[model samples]
Target: MEDRRRLLKALAACAMPGVAGTALATPASAQPWPVKPIRMVVPFPAGSSPDLIARLLTEKLAAALGQAVVVENRPGAGGNIGTGMVARAAPDGYTLLLTINGPLVTAPTLSRHLGYDPVRQLAPVSLVATSPNVLVVDARLPVHDVREFVALARSRPGVLNYGSVGNGSAAHLAMEQLKAAAGIDLQHIPYPGFAQITTAMVGGQVQAGFMVPVIAMPLVTAGKLRIIAVTTSGRTSLLPAVPTVAESGYPGFEAISWQAVLAPAGTPAPVIDRLYRELVAIIGSEDVRAKMRAQYFVPAGTAPQSLRQTMASEKVRWDKVIRAAGVQPE
Candidate 1:
């Protein structure tokens, strides 16, 4: 309500004699926002899930905002380098970030030199989508489910290794939390991205991992990997046959993979509110929802407060797991 009022006041100021002229004389900066291309930064590799989703928004957002929404991939340091770039960018609403929870939640707890504080440096736009991670292992592994896998890892202890895209990634933290809950010891191997992790698992270099269904399904379909259980609190509809880690034995386990859009902190509340509304509408559209579901994501066009709440809860949840896992900051 306050933001709407402020926006209205700004517009009404234009009606005042000489205010419009003064705004014009002040330069383009004084003009209406989004007069030029807006950059949407994806702190992950091109063609990754976040990348694809960012592209999905670009087309519609360009039309909706009457500006080119260009996507720039700035992948490195577990999504920190690019994330930090957006965090430090001028809060003029021209730059934005479409990233996952690594930098937002887990990395803060796990990385010592992380340059950005997500809570203080970024403002929420909306929760784009959420997907449960699936625990999968190479087909040749003797484990059939989470129980057997736990037993196998327990039997081997530190000998069994798991792969993740990078330290503090959702897959990394999910497996770490599982290791804590299941009382098993597994080595952590960081890969470049989802594809590399899958390749390593298929080659038998790493025994298992927790990854989104989009990346795990094809390997499972080709009989190169076997599904164990999901990280969600309950069984997901996309893979109903697989039980959740919580149901398997641990009663309250839940590690969801989610993505969100954010801008530098101190961005105008009016701009933030406008972004939140537009993004929610874009994600809620039938075509967007259908494609999101096809990629195994549950569309979540939630409000800014909802996104902030989820981030806080996830930080608390992952903080305990990261500490328990004894993953030292790098």
Candidate 2:
């Protein structure tokens, strides 16, 4: 009986440390994740809308999580370079991506050999914001509204040229979609970058082009460009006087440039959910919303499932538009 008691006591003693270890594990370590800085990669230049929105949200996020959120610019390949980087990054919560509509939706459609599958290789964190594309013309253009612009382009055909930020960019596709919908044939002149397109539009190098509201609003307000139509489902608060393309004639025309946050595809569910919770909070904050509006963007914080649906729908729609426009990949 004594030997049996000693054996039982020894077994109990052996199990004590294991039970205590489990109990004594620090819950703070598990709960207080993101002990280090978070890096957000932006696939565009510094002053671009994506960069502006990223900085705004990062500032708030950093403050909330007690970690520094740094933005790194990785512009190239029409946003593919940076996007690819994020798609190939470690699934840890530290690395993330901030990208616009083209990289997330249109690029996958246009580029047959994209290195990463946007839907399958990246986990959508949140929809940051979106800006309507504004159809802007040189201040010296002869047309004042969409009706006259279409008439003038139809009359001139291939003579009246329009500038695009790049060949497969959203701006280019928006203009092509408009042309297809309106049955007007304007010459497409591609520019190396958005800055050049703005310069060309302002200098009368190209008669008109489709640009994000943030990019063209200053030009319009300063009287360097004329806003004829906005490519949104409805009129924008920033440019309430401008008519939508649908209202102009084509009843279902809408082209918007949007941005979103994503992490690598294999990121753990725990990490993804945590990041998403924080992101939704950051994006929906009054300060972040105001900053986005000041940049001529509408706050759009969508869940991962919602973004997945958006990607599927947008891919189908943009594919048809690109095919109709006869856009060949570079």
TM-score of each: 0.89, 0.87
Q: Tens-digit lDDT track for model 2 on 41-107?
A: 9988777777888888888888877899999988876788789999999988889999887888888
In candidate 2, residue 261 scores what lDDT?
90
Of candidate 2, the 10-residue stretch with the lowest lDDT total is: 20-29
Model 1 regions lying over 4 Å from their true place: 1-29
Q: Tell me each candidate's RMSD, in Å, in order.
A: 7.0, 3.7
CA lDDT, candidate 2, residue 274: 76
| Tens digits of per-residue lDDT for model 1, 37-103 | 9999999888778887898888988888999999999988778889999999999999999999998
Residue 209 error for model 2, in Å? 1.4
